[model samples]
Target chain A: DAGITQSPRYKITETGRQVTLMCHQTWSHSYMFWYRQDLGHGLRLIYYSAAADITDKGEVPDGYVVSRSKTENFPLTLESATRSQTSVYFCASGLDRGRSYEQYFGPGTRLTVT
Target chain B: EDKVVQSPLSLVVHEGDTVTLNCSYEVTNFRSLLWYKQEKKAPTFLFMLTSSGIEKKSGRLSSILDKKELFSILNITATQTGDSAIYLCAIGANNLFFGTGTRLTVIP
Candidate 1:
Protein backbone atom coordinates (compact mmCIF):
# COMPACT_ATOMS: atom_id res chain seq x y z
CA ASP A 1 0.00 0.00 0.00
CA ALA A 2 2.99 2.25 0.52
CA GLY A 3 5.12 1.18 -2.41
CA ILE A 4 5.05 0.82 -6.18
CA THR A 5 2.84 -1.85 -7.80
CA GLN A 6 2.12 -3.03 -11.34
CA SER A 7 -0.99 -4.43 -12.92
CA PRO A 8 -1.51 -7.51 -15.08
CA ARG A 9 1.51 -9.22 -13.56
CA TYR A 10 1.57 -11.67 -16.45
CA LYS A 11 0.12 -11.13 -19.91
CA ILE A 12 0.00 -12.93 -23.24
CA THR A 13 -1.01 -11.37 -26.51
CA GLU A 14 -0.63 -11.74 -30.27
CA THR A 15 1.53 -9.62 -32.49
CA GLY A 16 0.11 -6.36 -33.93
CA ARG A 17 -2.24 -6.06 -30.95
CA GLN A 18 -2.12 -3.16 -28.55
CA VAL A 19 -1.06 -3.75 -24.93
CA THR A 20 -0.82 -1.46 -22.01
CA LEU A 21 0.97 -1.94 -18.68
CA MET A 22 -0.04 0.10 -15.68
CA CYS A 23 2.22 1.32 -12.88
CA HIS A 24 1.14 2.98 -9.64
CA GLN A 25 3.04 4.34 -6.72
CA THR A 26 1.85 5.66 -3.39
CA TRP A 27 4.90 7.78 -2.66
CA SER A 28 4.04 10.45 -5.22
CA HIS A 29 7.58 10.62 -6.47
CA SER A 30 8.53 13.09 -9.15
CA TYR A 31 10.31 10.66 -11.44
CA MET A 32 8.83 7.50 -12.92
CA PHE A 33 10.51 5.09 -15.33
CA TRP A 34 9.78 2.02 -17.47
CA TYR A 35 12.38 -0.60 -18.26
CA ARG A 36 12.45 -3.95 -20.03
CA GLN A 37 14.68 -6.73 -18.82
CA ASP A 38 16.00 -9.16 -21.37
CA LEU A 39 18.42 -12.08 -21.28
CA GLY A 40 21.48 -10.37 -22.79
CA HIS A 41 20.50 -6.71 -22.73
CA GLY A 42 19.83 -6.57 -19.01
CA LEU A 43 17.47 -3.77 -17.98
CA ARG A 44 16.99 -1.02 -20.54
CA LEU A 45 15.12 2.20 -20.05
CA ILE A 46 12.22 2.51 -22.43
CA TYR A 47 10.67 5.72 -21.20
CA TYR A 48 10.65 8.00 -18.17
CA SER A 49 8.61 10.90 -16.87
CA ALA A 50 9.91 13.79 -14.88
CA ALA A 51 6.42 14.63 -13.70
CA ALA A 52 2.82 14.44 -14.75
CA ASP A 53 2.25 15.27 -18.44
CA ILE A 54 5.99 15.19 -19.11
CA THR A 55 7.73 12.17 -20.64
CA ASP A 56 10.88 11.45 -22.60
CA LYS A 57 12.41 8.60 -24.58
CA GLY A 58 14.97 6.39 -22.94
CA GLU A 59 17.64 4.08 -24.37
CA VAL A 60 15.18 1.87 -26.27
CA PRO A 61 11.96 3.73 -26.93
CA ASP A 62 11.22 2.65 -30.45
CA GLY A 63 8.02 0.60 -29.99
CA TYR A 64 7.05 1.60 -26.48
CA VAL A 65 5.08 4.62 -25.32
CA VAL A 66 4.64 6.01 -21.83
CA SER A 67 2.58 8.68 -20.11
CA ARG A 68 2.29 10.08 -16.61
CA SER A 69 -1.11 11.63 -16.13
CA LYS A 70 -0.57 11.96 -12.41
CA THR A 71 2.33 11.89 -10.01
CA GLU A 72 1.29 8.47 -8.78
CA ASN A 73 0.57 6.80 -12.11
CA PHE A 74 2.78 6.07 -15.11
CA PRO A 75 1.55 3.73 -17.80
CA LEU A 76 3.41 2.10 -20.70
CA THR A 77 1.74 1.19 -23.94
CA LEU A 78 2.76 -1.00 -26.82
CA GLU A 79 0.96 0.33 -29.88
CA SER A 80 1.78 -2.66 -32.01
CA ALA A 81 3.18 -5.50 -30.01
CA THR A 82 5.79 -7.67 -31.67
CA ARG A 83 7.23 -11.03 -30.68
CA SER A 84 10.53 -9.30 -30.06
CA GLN A 85 8.79 -7.10 -27.49
CA THR A 86 8.29 -10.04 -25.17
CA SER A 87 10.15 -9.38 -21.95
CA VAL A 88 9.79 -8.56 -18.27
CA TYR A 89 8.71 -4.95 -17.80
CA PHE A 90 9.51 -3.00 -14.66
CA CYS A 91 8.25 0.33 -13.31
CA ALA A 92 10.12 2.45 -10.87
CA SER A 93 9.71 5.76 -9.01
CA GLY A 94 11.99 8.17 -7.22
CA LEU A 95 12.44 11.76 -6.21
CA ASP A 96 14.34 14.02 -8.56
CA ARG A 97 16.66 15.22 -5.85
CA GLY A 98 17.46 13.60 -2.55
CA ARG A 99 20.12 11.87 -0.54
CA SER A 100 18.53 8.62 -1.71
CA TYR A 101 17.50 9.25 -5.26
CA GLU A 102 17.54 5.52 -5.94
CA GLN A 103 14.56 4.21 -7.84
CA TYR A 104 12.26 1.68 -6.19
CA PHE A 105 10.87 -0.89 -8.63
CA GLY A 106 7.51 -2.57 -8.81
CA PRO A 107 6.66 -6.30 -8.96
CA GLY A 108 7.00 -6.20 -12.78
CA THR A 109 4.84 -7.42 -15.64
CA ARG A 110 5.80 -10.40 -17.78
CA LEU A 111 4.52 -9.82 -21.29
CA THR A 112 4.60 -12.45 -23.99
CA VAL A 113 3.86 -11.62 -27.59
CA THR A 114 3.06 -14.62 -29.70
CA GLU B 1 25.69 4.46 -26.07
CA ASP B 2 25.57 4.09 -22.27
CA LYS B 3 26.23 0.57 -21.11
CA VAL B 4 26.76 -1.48 -18.00
CA VAL B 5 28.47 -4.86 -17.99
CA GLN B 6 28.64 -7.37 -15.18
CA SER B 7 31.19 -10.15 -14.81
CA PRO B 8 31.01 -13.95 -14.35
CA LEU B 9 27.33 -13.92 -15.38
CA SER B 10 26.66 -16.64 -12.83
CA LEU B 11 28.40 -18.12 -9.82
CA VAL B 12 28.05 -20.98 -7.36
CA VAL B 13 29.63 -21.07 -3.93
CA HIS B 14 29.28 -22.69 -0.53
CA GLU B 15 27.53 -20.98 2.36
CA GLY B 16 30.70 -19.99 4.06
CA ASP B 17 32.52 -18.77 1.01
CA THR B 18 33.01 -15.15 0.13
CA VAL B 19 32.07 -13.79 -3.27
CA THR B 20 32.85 -10.73 -5.28
CA LEU B 21 30.56 -9.50 -8.02
CA ASN B 22 31.80 -6.99 -10.54
CA CYS B 23 30.14 -4.22 -12.59
CA SER B 24 31.68 -1.89 -15.13
CA TYR B 25 30.18 1.00 -16.99
CA GLU B 26 30.79 3.25 -20.01
CA VAL B 27 28.65 6.34 -19.96
CA THR B 28 28.72 10.13 -19.87
CA ASN B 29 27.96 12.45 -16.96
CA PHE B 30 29.31 9.85 -14.54
CA ARG B 31 27.31 10.10 -11.34
CA SER B 32 26.63 7.22 -8.96
CA LEU B 33 26.54 3.44 -8.91
CA LEU B 34 23.98 1.29 -7.12
CA TRP B 35 23.63 -2.36 -6.16
CA TYR B 36 20.43 -4.30 -5.80
CA LYS B 37 19.41 -7.81 -4.85
CA GLN B 38 16.64 -9.27 -6.97
CA GLU B 39 15.05 -12.48 -5.80
CA LYS B 40 11.68 -13.25 -7.35
CA LYS B 41 10.41 -9.81 -8.31
CA ALA B 42 11.43 -6.22 -7.96
CA PRO B 43 15.00 -5.40 -7.06
CA THR B 44 15.66 -4.16 -3.53
CA PHE B 45 18.36 -1.60 -2.95
CA LEU B 46 21.60 -2.62 -1.30
CA PHE B 47 24.13 0.19 -1.61
CA MET B 48 24.78 3.35 -3.58
CA LEU B 49 28.34 4.42 -4.28
CA THR B 50 29.05 7.88 -5.65
CA SER B 51 32.56 8.35 -4.42
CA SER B 52 35.60 6.38 -5.41
CA GLY B 53 37.83 4.33 -3.08
CA ILE B 54 35.52 4.69 -0.10
CA GLU B 55 34.05 1.31 0.59
CA LYS B 56 30.47 1.06 1.81
CA LYS B 57 29.65 -1.83 4.12
CA SER B 58 26.60 -3.22 5.81
CA GLY B 59 26.62 -6.40 7.86
CA ARG B 60 28.72 -8.78 5.76
CA LEU B 61 28.20 -6.98 2.47
CA SER B 62 30.51 -4.34 1.08
CA SER B 63 31.10 -2.50 -2.20
CA ILE B 64 33.61 -0.09 -3.67
CA LEU B 65 33.59 2.17 -6.73
CA ASP B 66 36.51 3.07 -8.97
CA LYS B 67 35.82 6.16 -11.03
CA LYS B 68 39.24 6.01 -12.63
CA GLU B 69 38.63 2.50 -13.97
CA LEU B 70 34.88 2.85 -14.48
CA PHE B 71 34.04 -0.23 -12.44
CA SER B 72 32.70 -1.38 -9.09
CA ILE B 73 32.85 -4.56 -7.06
CA LEU B 74 30.39 -5.94 -4.54
CA ASN B 75 31.70 -8.25 -1.85
CA ILE B 76 29.72 -10.57 0.35
CA THR B 77 31.51 -12.43 3.14
CA ALA B 78 30.27 -15.54 4.94
CA THR B 79 27.59 -16.04 2.39
CA GLN B 80 24.29 -17.62 3.27
CA THR B 81 21.55 -19.31 1.31
CA GLY B 82 19.60 -16.12 1.64
CA ASP B 83 22.34 -14.36 -0.25
CA SER B 84 21.57 -16.45 -3.32
CA ALA B 85 19.92 -13.97 -5.62
CA ILE B 86 20.58 -11.99 -8.76
CA TYR B 87 22.86 -9.10 -7.92
CA LEU B 88 22.18 -6.10 -10.10
CA CYS B 89 24.42 -3.11 -10.70
CA ALA B 90 23.15 0.16 -12.10
CA ILE B 91 24.75 3.43 -12.99
CA GLY B 92 22.74 6.54 -12.23
CA ALA B 93 23.36 9.67 -14.22
CA ASN B 94 19.98 11.42 -13.91
CA ASN B 95 18.58 8.07 -15.09
CA LEU B 96 19.73 4.51 -14.49
CA PHE B 97 21.52 2.11 -16.81
CA PHE B 98 21.49 -1.41 -15.42
CA GLY B 99 23.74 -4.40 -15.93
CA THR B 100 22.32 -7.78 -16.79
CA GLY B 101 23.01 -8.92 -13.21
CA THR B 102 24.99 -11.79 -11.71
CA ARG B 103 23.05 -14.86 -10.68
CA LEU B 104 24.59 -16.07 -7.45
CA THR B 105 23.91 -19.37 -5.76
CA VAL B 106 25.02 -20.09 -2.24
CA ILE B 107 24.60 -23.79 -1.69
CA PRO B 108 24.08 -25.06 1.78
Candidate 2:
Protein backbone atom coordinates (compact mmCIF):
# COMPACT_ATOMS: atom_id res chain seq x y z
CA ASP A 1 0.00 0.00 0.00
CA ALA A 2 3.05 2.24 0.32
CA GLY A 3 5.16 1.61 -2.76
CA ILE A 4 5.34 2.75 -6.38
CA THR A 5 2.31 2.16 -8.59
CA GLN A 6 1.69 2.44 -12.34
CA SER A 7 -1.65 2.98 -14.01
CA PRO A 8 -3.31 0.83 -16.73
CA ARG A 9 -0.97 -2.12 -16.22
CA TYR A 10 -1.73 -3.05 -19.82
CA LYS A 11 -2.60 -0.75 -22.70
CA ILE A 12 -3.35 -1.30 -26.39
CA THR A 13 -3.34 1.61 -28.81
CA GLU A 14 -3.04 2.33 -32.51
CA THR A 15 -0.36 4.23 -34.34
CA GLY A 16 -0.38 8.03 -34.13
CA ARG A 17 -2.53 7.86 -31.02
CA GLN A 18 -1.40 9.72 -27.95
CA VAL A 19 -1.20 7.94 -24.62
CA THR A 20 0.20 8.63 -21.22
CA LEU A 21 1.28 6.25 -18.46
CA MET A 22 1.19 7.46 -14.91
CA CYS A 23 3.65 6.71 -12.09
CA HIS A 24 3.41 7.64 -8.48
CA GLN A 25 5.55 6.87 -5.46
CA THR A 26 4.86 7.45 -1.81
CA TRP A 27 8.47 7.62 -0.70
CA SER A 28 9.04 11.06 -2.18
CA HIS A 29 12.38 10.18 -3.67
CA SER A 30 14.67 12.90 -4.93
CA TYR A 31 15.20 11.24 -8.32
CA MET A 32 12.69 9.51 -10.58
CA PHE A 33 13.29 7.57 -13.80
CA TRP A 34 11.45 5.97 -16.71
CA TYR A 35 12.78 2.90 -18.48
CA ARG A 36 11.67 0.73 -21.39
CA GLN A 37 12.33 -2.99 -21.71
CA ASP A 38 12.43 -4.73 -25.07
CA LEU A 39 13.25 -8.27 -26.12
CA GLY A 40 16.99 -8.93 -26.28
CA HIS A 41 17.59 -5.64 -24.50
CA GLY A 42 17.55 -5.06 -20.77
CA LEU A 43 16.23 -1.77 -19.48
CA ARG A 44 17.09 1.56 -21.07
CA LEU A 45 16.39 4.85 -19.39
CA ILE A 46 13.87 7.04 -21.20
CA TYR A 47 13.82 10.05 -18.95
CA TYR A 48 14.93 11.00 -15.45
CA SER A 49 13.96 13.83 -13.13
CA ALA A 50 16.26 15.11 -10.44
CA ALA A 51 13.58 16.99 -8.55
CA ALA A 52 10.20 18.56 -9.02
CA ASP A 53 9.93 20.37 -12.40
CA ILE A 54 13.43 19.21 -13.38
CA THR A 55 13.67 16.59 -16.12
CA ASP A 56 16.35 15.35 -18.52
CA LYS A 57 16.49 13.07 -21.54
CA GLY A 58 17.81 9.58 -21.16
CA GLU A 59 19.19 7.09 -23.68
CA VAL A 60 15.89 6.65 -25.59
CA PRO A 61 13.86 9.80 -25.16
CA ASP A 62 13.25 10.58 -28.81
CA GLY A 63 9.52 9.68 -29.01
CA TYR A 64 8.74 10.03 -25.31
CA VAL A 65 8.20 12.91 -22.92
CA VAL A 66 8.25 12.99 -19.14
CA SER A 67 7.52 15.58 -16.47
CA ARG A 68 7.68 15.61 -12.70
CA SER A 69 5.13 18.05 -11.38
CA LYS A 70 5.67 16.75 -7.85
CA THR A 71 8.15 14.53 -6.09
CA GLU A 72 5.62 11.69 -5.97
CA ASN A 73 4.54 11.75 -9.62
CA PHE A 74 6.42 11.32 -12.89
CA PRO A 75 4.30 10.77 -15.95
CA LEU A 76 5.45 9.63 -19.40
CA THR A 77 3.67 10.57 -22.61
CA LEU A 78 3.90 9.28 -26.12
CA GLU A 79 3.21 12.14 -28.54
CA SER A 80 2.31 9.74 -31.35
CA ALA A 81 2.66 6.03 -30.83
CA THR A 82 4.31 3.73 -33.32
CA ARG A 83 4.59 -0.05 -33.60
CA SER A 84 8.22 0.26 -32.57
CA GLN A 85 7.09 1.87 -29.33
CA THR A 86 5.51 -1.32 -28.06
CA SER A 87 7.39 -2.44 -24.99
CA VAL A 88 7.18 -2.71 -21.22
CA TYR A 89 7.55 0.59 -19.42
CA PHE A 90 8.89 0.80 -15.88
CA CYS A 91 8.95 3.70 -13.42
CA ALA A 92 11.65 3.90 -10.79
CA SER A 93 12.55 6.23 -7.92
CA GLY A 94 15.80 6.73 -6.06
CA LEU A 95 16.63 8.59 -2.89
CA ASP A 96 19.64 9.98 -4.65
CA ARG A 97 21.30 8.50 -7.73
CA GLY A 98 23.00 5.24 -8.60
CA ARG A 99 22.11 1.99 -6.78
CA SER A 100 23.54 2.98 -3.44
CA TYR A 101 20.15 2.84 -1.77
CA GLU A 102 18.41 0.67 -4.38
CA GLN A 103 15.85 2.41 -6.56
CA TYR A 104 12.27 1.18 -6.20
CA PHE A 105 10.44 0.16 -9.40
CA GLY A 106 6.77 -0.10 -10.21
CA PRO A 107 5.00 -3.21 -11.45
CA GLY A 108 5.47 -1.94 -15.03
CA THR A 109 2.99 -1.18 -17.82
CA ARG A 110 2.86 -3.32 -20.92
CA LEU A 111 2.00 -1.19 -23.96
CA THR A 112 1.23 -2.50 -27.41
CA VAL A 113 0.98 -0.30 -30.48
CA THR A 114 -0.84 -1.84 -33.38
CA GLU B 1 28.78 5.78 -22.35
CA ASP B 2 28.62 3.35 -19.42
CA LYS B 3 27.75 -0.25 -20.26
CA VAL B 4 27.00 -3.47 -18.39
CA VAL B 5 27.09 -6.99 -19.82
CA GLN B 6 25.78 -10.22 -18.29
CA SER B 7 26.80 -13.69 -19.36
CA PRO B 8 24.91 -16.98 -19.89
CA LEU B 9 21.94 -14.89 -20.91
CA SER B 10 19.76 -17.67 -19.51
CA LEU B 11 20.15 -20.73 -17.33
CA VAL B 12 18.03 -23.66 -16.19
CA VAL B 13 18.75 -25.51 -12.98
CA HIS B 14 17.17 -27.92 -10.57
CA GLU B 15 16.15 -26.99 -7.06
CA GLY B 16 18.86 -27.55 -4.45
CA ASP B 17 21.53 -26.77 -7.00
CA THR B 18 23.97 -23.89 -6.95
CA VAL B 19 24.15 -21.32 -9.72
CA THR B 20 26.49 -18.48 -10.50
CA LEU B 21 25.56 -15.47 -12.62
CA ASN B 22 28.16 -13.15 -14.07
CA CYS B 23 28.20 -9.44 -14.83
CA SER B 24 30.92 -7.26 -16.29
CA TYR B 25 31.01 -3.56 -16.91
CA GLU B 26 32.84 -0.54 -18.32
CA VAL B 27 31.76 2.51 -16.41
CA THR B 28 33.25 5.93 -15.80
CA ASN B 29 33.44 7.15 -12.23
CA PHE B 30 32.47 3.79 -10.85
CA ARG B 31 30.94 3.78 -7.41
CA SER B 32 29.27 0.41 -6.78
CA LEU B 33 27.64 -2.72 -8.24
CA LEU B 34 24.14 -3.97 -7.50
CA TRP B 35 22.08 -7.10 -8.06
CA TYR B 36 18.32 -7.40 -8.28
CA LYS B 37 15.90 -10.33 -8.42
CA GLN B 38 12.93 -9.77 -10.68
CA GLU B 39 9.90 -12.04 -10.76
CA LYS B 40 6.80 -11.02 -12.73
CA LYS B 41 7.03 -7.45 -11.49
CA ALA B 42 9.52 -4.93 -10.23
CA PRO B 43 13.04 -5.99 -9.42
CA THR B 44 13.85 -6.25 -5.73
CA PHE B 45 17.31 -5.42 -4.50
CA LEU B 46 19.47 -8.38 -3.56
CA PHE B 47 22.91 -7.01 -2.88
CA MET B 48 25.01 -3.90 -3.40
CA LEU B 49 28.75 -4.33 -3.37
CA THR B 50 30.85 -1.23 -2.89
CA SER B 51 34.24 -2.80 -2.44
CA SER B 52 36.23 -5.71 -3.79
CA GLY B 53 37.04 -8.97 -1.93
CA ILE B 54 34.20 -8.48 0.51
CA GLU B 55 31.11 -10.61 -0.07
CA LYS B 56 27.60 -9.50 0.73
CA LYS B 57 24.95 -12.02 1.65
CA SER B 58 21.21 -12.10 2.06
CA GLY B 59 19.49 -15.39 2.74
CA ARG B 60 20.74 -17.82 0.10
CA LEU B 61 21.96 -15.06 -2.20
CA SER B 62 25.52 -13.77 -2.14
CA SER B 63 27.52 -11.48 -4.39
CA ILE B 64 31.07 -10.21 -4.79
CA LEU B 65 32.58 -7.49 -6.91
CA ASP B 66 36.08 -7.41 -8.32
CA LYS B 67 36.92 -3.87 -9.26
CA LYS B 68 40.26 -4.74 -10.79
CA GLU B 69 38.58 -7.19 -13.19
CA LEU B 70 35.56 -4.99 -13.73
CA PHE B 71 33.23 -7.88 -13.04
CA SER B 72 30.82 -9.28 -10.45
CA ILE B 73 29.18 -12.60 -9.73
CA LEU B 74 26.06 -13.62 -7.85
CA ASN B 75 25.85 -17.04 -6.22
CA ILE B 76 22.63 -18.64 -5.13
CA THR B 77 23.09 -21.70 -3.01
CA ALA B 78 20.48 -24.36 -2.25
CA THR B 79 18.25 -22.78 -4.80
CA GLN B 80 14.54 -23.13 -4.44
CA THR B 81 11.72 -22.93 -6.95
CA GLY B 82 11.09 -19.40 -5.78
CA ASP B 83 14.56 -18.57 -6.98
CA SER B 84 13.36 -18.58 -10.56
CA ALA B 85 13.63 -15.04 -11.78
CA ILE B 86 15.76 -12.64 -13.75
CA TYR B 87 18.92 -11.61 -11.94
CA LEU B 88 19.99 -8.19 -13.11
CA CYS B 89 23.47 -6.81 -12.57
CA ALA B 90 23.92 -3.07 -12.60
CA ILE B 91 27.04 -0.95 -12.50
CA GLY B 92 26.57 2.37 -10.81
CA ALA B 93 28.54 5.50 -11.28
CA ASN B 94 26.80 8.80 -10.78
CA ASN B 95 23.92 6.95 -12.43
CA LEU B 96 23.06 3.27 -12.54
CA PHE B 97 23.59 1.27 -15.75
CA PHE B 98 21.99 -2.21 -15.87
CA GLY B 99 23.11 -5.24 -17.84
CA THR B 100 20.94 -7.37 -20.07
CA GLY B 101 20.18 -9.65 -17.08
CA THR B 102 20.50 -13.39 -16.52
CA ARG B 103 17.24 -15.26 -16.55
CA LEU B 104 17.41 -18.21 -14.16
CA THR B 105 14.82 -20.91 -13.77
CA VAL B 106 14.94 -23.38 -10.93
CA ILE B 107 12.82 -26.44 -11.55
CA PRO B 108 11.57 -28.98 -9.06
- The lDDT leader among the candidates is 1
Worst 10 residues of 2 chain A by lDDT: A95-104
Candidate 1: tens digits of C-alpha lDDT, residues A57-108:
9889999888777899999999999999999999999886643349899999
**What TM-score, to 2 decimal places, does chain A of model 2 have?**
0.95
Candidate 2 clashing pairs, residues 3+ apart or interchain: none
- Candidate 1 residue runs with Cα over 4 Å from true position: A98-101
C-alpha lDDT of residue A54 in model 2:
98
Per-residue lDDT of candidate 2, residues B40-101 (tens digit): 98888888899999999888889999999999999999999999999999877766778989
lDDT of 2 at A20: 100
C-alpha DockQ for predicted model 1: 0.82
| Cα deviation of B72, candidate 1, in Å | 1.0
Please write out the lDDT profile of model 2 over residues A1-114, one tens digit for every residue.
788999989999999999999999998789888989887888888998899999998788999988888899999999999999999999999886544347889999999999
Residue pairs in steric clash, candidate 1? Answer: none
Recovered native contacts, candidate 1: 0.81
